[model samples]
Target: MTLSKKIEHLEQVLNQPAENFANSFKSDIILFFDDNFSENNTQLFFLNDLNSKEEIQSWVEILTSRFVMKFEAEFEAENDFINDYLENG
Candidate 1:
């Protein structure tokens, strides 16, 4: 898939509700990089193509930050629910 398509796929996955969010994210990211490596002929391209490597690195950083924010928000919401239940019960 093209870079845009891959990004779109990631966005889609990010929006979906997953029973296991971390595992889902890991599996999707692994598949995304695997496809990228195949498209570039191999992972060695990362070593030779500075621009491509930088672009991918940027994306990884952005994605990781987003994932962390999302996970934290979810965790806080769940924690709040548990606290409310305990207080009310």
Candidate 2:
């Protein structure tokens, strides 16, 4: 997906009512610019305005599963740290 499209999709996910994020936290988004998406400076936002242990665990699961499925080794050999962080951080 294009950078803008990815951000738009993520925005939709982040804005979902079921997420139950703090209003102030919603505005404090953390976006990571990936070298893998250097063509468009694709931003990967793993988590945002998370305030509880459950949210943190949810973010970890979401990130780990997404990374393993989308960015498996062959495409990101040099970015092992990123994948590791996503899984273990």
Candidate 3:
């Protein structure tokens, strides 16, 4: 299906009552369309942006950050910088 249809489908799925869905669930949604299609790809990207918006309900959280268990010294060194910014700013 096209991106628009995929987005509409997601909205419909999310519309179910709280009891209908599990507390933690995983869904993989992909839009299959030819690259040479005439329509602009912007609409697809826009819909993705909406998915991460705060206006959406509780279950819709965008995994937009790097979720890593561990990293190298370089990454650890920056932790102080981040913490300082958080403390000061």
| Global lDDT scores for all candidate models | 0.43, 0.43, 0.34
Error of 3 at 53 (Å): 22
The local lDDT score (0 to 100) that residue 46 gets in candidate 1 is 34
Best of the two (2, 3) by TM-score: 2
- Which whole-number lDDT from 0 to 100 does residue 13 have in model 2? 46
Model 3 regions more than 4 Å off: 20-89
Predicted candidate 1 versus true structure: per-residue lDDT over 1-89, tens digit per residue: 45544454444444455455343444444453453433344432332322443454454445544455554553455334323322342
Cα lDDT for residue 7, candidate 2? 49
Q: Which stretches of candidate 2 lie over 4 Å from their true place?
A: 1-48, 78-89
What is the C-alpha lDDT profile of model 3 across 12-86, one tens digit per residue?
Answer: 544444452331221211122122222354423434434433423332332101112222447554344323322
Candidates 1 and 2 compared by TM-score, better number: 2
Give the range where candidate 3 is weakest over 10 consecutive residues by summed lDDT: 62-71
Clashing pairs in 1: none
Clashing pairs in 3: none
Best by TM-score: 2
Say which prediction, candidate 1 or candidate 3, comes out ahead on TM-score: 1
Pairwise lDDT winner, candidates 1 and 3: 1
